[model samples]
Target: MSAKTIVVGNFKGGVGKTKVAVMASWELAHEMNKKVLLIDMDPQANATTLIARSAGITEIESSIFESFENSDLSKSVLNVKENLDLIPAAVSFKNLPKFLYGKFSDDIDQVSYLKTLLEPLKKNYDYIFIDVPPTISDYSDNAMMAADYVLIILQAQELSLEGAETYISYLQFMIDEYNAYIQVAGVLPVLLRPGGRVDHATVERAKELFGEDNVFENYIKHLERLKAWDITGITYKDHHDNRAHQIFIEVVQEMLDKIEHFEGGEVNGE
Candidate 1:
């Protein structure tokens, strides 16, 4: 089966991009029992640390920097458990762009070189989930072109809303001008507004601006369990009974159903 490569990205940071990427990868691997590959393209390496212990400052060999520069990345990958593999990250990833900038001076496709390198691994896993940085860097561009579906997570707050608009406009331009095959899954509205409110007014505004059908039907509430992983190294599968973990399981199922829907005209319908 051709696995669906999904990317979790946002132009604005602190919207839980790493959280969703880690949780989704675990859910797909453990709950769905599908082989999952987690690629950390973020220099912060938050997702890598959360998934694998002691990241951010650690010198991980299987990181994107080494692999992107023609290092033996395949050997750096670690088996997280049954059906889950991880390409960890290091602080060195911050310099990947400068390292690769001079390699292909005239090639427009050079930005997507990482994705092309990873394409061969499509046969090695059932699902590939990428955690991209919160900026429009070369890493983000690589993830965008490589992904079969892109999920943009955002909050309803003023700053995040503005970010959504700006991000949509820019990526839309890129889709029109560069990658036409890139498919935007939806804007996942993470209801981080305090007091557990959705601000239906804002939701309606977004739907009016970007299409009602394109908006995700479900929203992840602001839960303490969602942030509990910050101090802990356990991922969703490791803390299977936690509320946030279960929610992640549900969210991954939702994404898988969407993938099935797009591939053929059917959802899991369960």
Candidate 2:
């Protein structure tokens, strides 16, 4: 089977999107032994910085911008691990919207550009993850269009929950108008506290809005160790006893299950 492209996104920032992307890549590469390429589509480049730091890469000589300029994904790909690779994003991607405006024919073709650029690399990896920016822009559009499934991440905050609904509505709109290939992998809740009242309430409300099955049974508890790992360039394998690491392993398992069983948006009349 071809690689399954999953975009980790939410219209709300500070929702731990990068953390989840980084953890998922680690789990897929080291645990599941999957060849994974993580594309950092966020101009903030948190995922890029995290992976680069972990790989001891101090200078970023090439990046995703090169792919946009030359349609050569190879130019930007960094082999960070035995099975993990990354297409690092730069702050320069802030200019992508203006660049895309003049490059593609119309809105439809503009969003479709990423799929064309990454098509040649599809067979090289078992999974590809796109880490998108928080807002609706050419970057997120391209990621969504290029993806087979989107994994929406949100914290159990009021604004985050509201933004999740808005983001899903936007996805539905995209499916109706431009891409019918994408469906939601699941809505993952990152709880600041595992059993906090706010977290419980938010999960229940999310089930009410998106359906219980649409949300994953497992939730990632907020762990301070994760932040330290990000800063220290420590992989979960090295931090073997950390509960956050175990939680991510469960999350990865759930992702694999969902992807395996996903009927496709087109098949489900989405």
Candidate 3:
């Protein structure tokens, strides 16, 4: 089965991009029993740290950079759980741009290198989720080039909204310039506060800008448990943890629905 590769990102930092990517991958693998692979494209390695904690790994032996350098990502795969796997990132991944330029003469080859490398492994999983840094760089370019869909994270602020818009614009640029076959999955809102004035106004503005249907109905409310997961490594120890997990489960279900709709030839933002 060919996996549906999705890149979760935003052009603004602190918009919960890595959190959404990690939790969504966790829910899909741990909760729904799906074979999932999470590829951390961010050099910060936040996703790597959390998943490593979950797997009880104190030190990273390998990273995606090694896979890229070796031209075989399978060699770097680390099993996080029963159905979950991860290709961790390293700070050394910042050298990717230089490596790409040194390896390929054409810009297309540079941008699409990750896609070429990932194609062979697509048949091994149900889904492949990529978490990239919040910027327009080699990391994001490679991730976008390799993905079938991009899930934009909107954190319910004016700057975040602008970042989402800029991200969509860049996605379109990728499609038009390099012929990357990808689509915007949908905008998932991460609220600063549930029912707060800024949160309400931001979401309304997002719906108007991105179209009502293009914005997810189920949003992520600010939760202490989510913050705790950064340190505790995604535990489900209490009622609050279950509640937070349930919220992502709903979001993921909706994401699947949107993907199905897109596959059926439904136009986005319609």
Candidate 4:
């Protein structure tokens, strides 16, 4: 089977996109024993920092933008662990938009540049996850056009729900204008406060907007360990918190199920 590329993205910031991208890729690699390649498409590189910290990597030598400009993807790849690999990001990636502008004219397939770069390595892994920035830019568009599926991360809040819709709309725009072949895996709700009325309403609104099946059943609840990971650069395993660990496990299982189901249906001509 070819690698299934899932881009974790949102149109707004601070809604746990990197958290879901990092933890989901970690669980898939460590627990499920799958070969996973995580590309840090965002210039902020939070996902890169989290994965790099876990592996004791202090500095990244090459950023993913090198693949776009130089046509050598191997320069950016780093073996982070047994089953996990990374193409880390750097602050210099912020200059990619300007560089891309010079490479692609109005008639060129600008958005498909990443897809072309990643095509040669499609069969190297079981999964490839890309972490995109919050806004829709040249980088995020490259990620979107490169993905087989898009996993949108949302929080249990009104503004986040709206952000989820905005991202879905952007996906539609890409499909319509650029002829990108991609689908939404699902909308994952994070930071769930179970007992709060606002949280309940937000969940219901998500179901109503995206359909019950389109939104994942397992929601990632807020936990102190997750918050601490950002500061101390610790992992879910380092904390020994079953609550947070199990939540990530369930999410990985759900993600696996969706991908298998989607891919199988595609193969059988469903």
State the lDDT of candidate 3 residue by residue for 1-67, as single tens digits: 7889999978988888998999999999988878899999999999999888867888778999999
What TM-score would you give candidate 1 relative to the actual structure?
0.88
**What are the runs in model 3 whose C-alpha is more than 4 Å off?**
157-160, 193-198, 265-270
lDDT of candidate model 3 versus the reference: 0.88
Compared with the true structure, model 2 gives a TM-score of: 0.91
173-236: candidate 2 lDDT, tens digit per residue: 8899895588888989886553443467777888888877878888777676777777877554
Once fitted onto the true fold, the runs of candidate 2 whose alpha carbons sit more than 4 angstroms away are 157-160, 193-198, 236-241, 263-270
**Which residue window of length 10 is worst by lDDT in model 3?**
191-200
Off by over 4 Å in 1: 54-59, 157-160, 235-241, 265-270
Candidate 3 structure, TM-score to reference: 0.94
Better of 3 and 4 by TM-score: 3
Q: Estimate each model's TM-score.
A: 0.88, 0.91, 0.94, 0.91
**For each predicted model, how many residue pairs clash, with residues at least 3 apart or on different chains?**
0, 0, 0, 0
Range of the 10 consecutive residues with the lowest summed lDDT in candidate 1: 53-62
Measured with C-alpha atoms, the lDDT of residue 237 in candidate 4 is: 56
Q: How high is the lDDT of residue 257 in model 4?
A: 79
- RMSD of each candidate relative to the true structure: 3.4, 3.6, 3.3, 2.8
